[model samples]
Target: MGIRLMALALIPMLPHLPFGQSSLSTSPLGIGTVKWGRTEGLKHAPFSLPDDATLHQLLDAAEAAGINVLDSAPAYGLAESRLGSLLASRPNRFHVFTKAGESFSHGASFWDFSESAIRRSVENSLRLLRTDRLDAVTLHCPRHDLSVLSQSDAPAVLSSLKSEGKILLSGFSVMSLDAGLLAVPHFDYLMVAWNPGFLEHQPVIEAAALARKGILLKKVLSSGSFTSVSPAESLRAARNLPGNPVILAGTINPHHLRDNIAALT
Candidate 1:
């Protein structure tokens, strides 16, 4: 896309939610940082983390392209810390969205949705991200059932954090519709998967939109499963979906970043 299209007008803004003294308004597209830190247990080809200079360039490109939201997680290896260091000198330029309830260690992933675990995770994220108040944080639900939220007090912990002003928006990320349905009432936003090849989460998206909650679409490119379709096509499909969800693209290449932004046009 041209520089003109790369302005803040490229993507439509989602409805704002009251967050303390200010409100939260996110772009229709966000840059996912899974590849920013870890490289194990991924479907993509083997790759290494970019150097500081390269990451700085990528952040520059993203900001110049009008992307103001970033998705990260504790399970994403050193993504949060690296991002924290990179963003330390440049604070409040982007809305940093992270997760709790999951962590990565010894080259394997682990899940813990207990109230204490969630609280500890959020606190660690705050220290690592170098921010006093998180723009948004959600429970990282790796399970396929509602037990992750229903059986545990993770959602309540997020609520408490929000009450204390430690975080602005709270939500959950799930892989199943049932879990998404359960999360709707508890979260101010949701991170769910949706792409052309998979539409199982359509009901969840519709329901969240109908409820007037923010929706973030993950795996929109199916983790590079867009063999038969272009990335733009997948993004366009997401834009047409309910809630005008923010499509999170996890591309590390600068060229691909621009291409993804162009796709939104």
Candidate 2:
């Protein structure tokens, strides 16, 4: 299995992406805000929800640090709305990527891959995000097999939305490597859970890069647990693979944000 890693320096060669032409950060480190206004749900329950002022302050600090990419999802309560409100006030200041296909209700997760659901999801995101067109929308980590996702009409619906200029690209935040490999060729990008300790995604990550598909990465801190490892080690031996991934570091803590930024520059 031969692997050829692409350089992060090749981002300039990428075609004009839907992310508006703004003076955004060149670093692949992005701010992932899952705890903005969200709490009492998700993997770890009872997470603290920051006040609106604090949220605004965090965004200001992130942008001031040249981290302009944001990753959000409907499952993350208050994340989309809070980021939307802030980003609306400053258009093109951040490249916001959101998710569909999976949503939460009453602390339970639900999967909806129907064509109508996908359409509705995109529309809702556009409305909540306060953007005329979204930069990118992922499949929100569908747990079903590839056959189910492939059989669904959701992809066609997203493609239609893309043609209509409502969204720039369709992709997935994949949890299953099999699904990720099977699904990557059909979409514009895929965000895989990656960290120095997790090696399960290396093949799929490299494959996506080899296919010339865009890639985003999550779990930079192993889902917010950075104990047991040093930042320097993770930064060095962590991404020893082909191509560069925009690491979505979800942290409202300024110190963690600074450390995430250090992972790149």
Candidate 3:
């Protein structure tokens, strides 16, 4: 049976990423969990991590708004473990997307895309997330670009894990147009940055769409720096992009979540 997403609001599904390669009905707007844990290497003004109560409230608000996907990464500090504990009661209700190849330590980010490191990272993510399998696992390429896929064992490792049922999908996340385009034909889906001010990655989105691959967009708010444009308008513009990519918005406030959902609707 397909994993059904239970929500109080109606959530529209994007075109099947590659049309039946897998069975994942993704919501256009996903919740980003960076602020649920990590404190360093953030672009937004410094703020306190939400307490458990606040986090629970945020989750509730997200579910009510039909936001089913939660994007987390090891570099986000305690986000994975916290989500594991909080959602332990109903893990199947949401699609859990995470990353390998990047981690945080001493308030700094690190990279590891080797064969053994990628395998170990996938295992660790499974253990921490309290789920036997992850919905999607992407290479968290920050310092490197598409070359990382060829120079390292990340591709083969991710492919092996998918065969083993450790993850449902494998993809790439990067910050550059050339790299993003280079990665399009290499993975199942992609996570790229797009907004009104930053249109450098527009070609990447177009290419991914032509390939019929799934796409997840990050930095929709430009790290909370939307000056002239409102968040709602920005989200509306992203939805109209090629492939109808899923937009990941990182916000700790429930009110903001509602506003974002409103824009997408």
Candidate 4:
């Protein structure tokens, strides 16, 4: 659903705007591609990766629907490679946001924030995403340990990539307010979880908004269960959480994608 610019208090990321109209601007909506490539590897996954035809149709739908950002990571099976290949045809269609630090092997996670590790991760992402540059690179750190990310050379590594014009935004996908606050000073964007049932990081999101950093919301639809909540209701609850947030809805179903685009405005 389209996001409105009304009463969006605390942070006027986008000040006054009308309701029922989706903004064509770049900040409000994004697609998370975890299920786009493979579903068997992640927790709570309910679908398998799509074939080429389905993925092509999905991208077509995204383009027709005016969706702008596509979020993916190396940990998301073949998501990066698929995107790299598929998106080459529509290079300017959507912005790409991916991550480093946390990786997967045998469906298990491994974390490394050392300078070299970060560098290798970024380089690999560049190759896999089929781009010399990335829109944003997040430190995929665990929530509880997020506050200590600065101890690693991650910020420096991302900064170097930014300096080389390879990254537009640098950030972290954090799990706690303390970690979110710590990330505010160092990142351009912060990915946090905010849904109807979870509000523990509301303050952290507000803090991020106060700092003028962009916020990307994960699990907005409650892992697609949305429980008994309708998309509009779920989106409303998300708006009530905190921050001038951006929704990252991961879906392979075209109808859901359309519904997701229309729920909030």
> Evaluated with TM-score, which candidate comes out highest?
3
Better of 1 and 4 by lDDT: 1
Report per-prediction Cα RMSD to one decimal: 3.7, 8.3, 4.4, 7.1
TM-score, every prediction: 0.91, 0.85, 0.91, 0.85
User: Mind sharing the TM-score for model 1?
Assistant: 0.91
Question: Model 4 off-target regions past 4 Å?
Answer: 1-27, 147-150, 239-243
Worst 10 residues of 1 by lDDT: 13-22
The digit string of per-residue lDDT tens for model 4 on 1-265 reads 3332221121212222211112223546578898886666555556667787777766766665566678898788889999999998897788788999888878688888888898899889999988888878888876555544757788888888889888777878987677777777777878888777777877768887777677788887778675767777877676655455777877888667656656654
Deviation from native of the Cα of residue 123 in model 1, angstroms:
0.9
Supply the TM-score for candidate 3.
0.91
Clashes of 4: 5
lDDT of 2 by residue, 142-253 (tens): 5665754568787777789889999987877787888888877777777888787887977878888888677777886677566778764565454455555666767777
- The candidate, 1 or 3, that scores higher on lDDT is 3
User: What digit string (tens of lDDT, one per residue) describes model 1 on residues 132-235?
Assistant: 88989978887555887768888888889999999999978877888898778778888888888888988989888888788889998889866787898998
Summing lDDT over every window of 10 consecutive residues in candidate 3, give the lowest-scoring window: 12-21
lDDT of 3 by residue, 48-154 (tens): 98898888877776776666788999889999999999898765778889999999999788898998899889999999999888889989997557567668889
Q: List the residue pairs that clash in candidate 4.
A: 1-260, 1-261, 1-262, 1-263, 2-265
Query: Cα deviation of 138 in candidate 1 (Å)?
Result: 1.2
lDDT of 3: 0.83
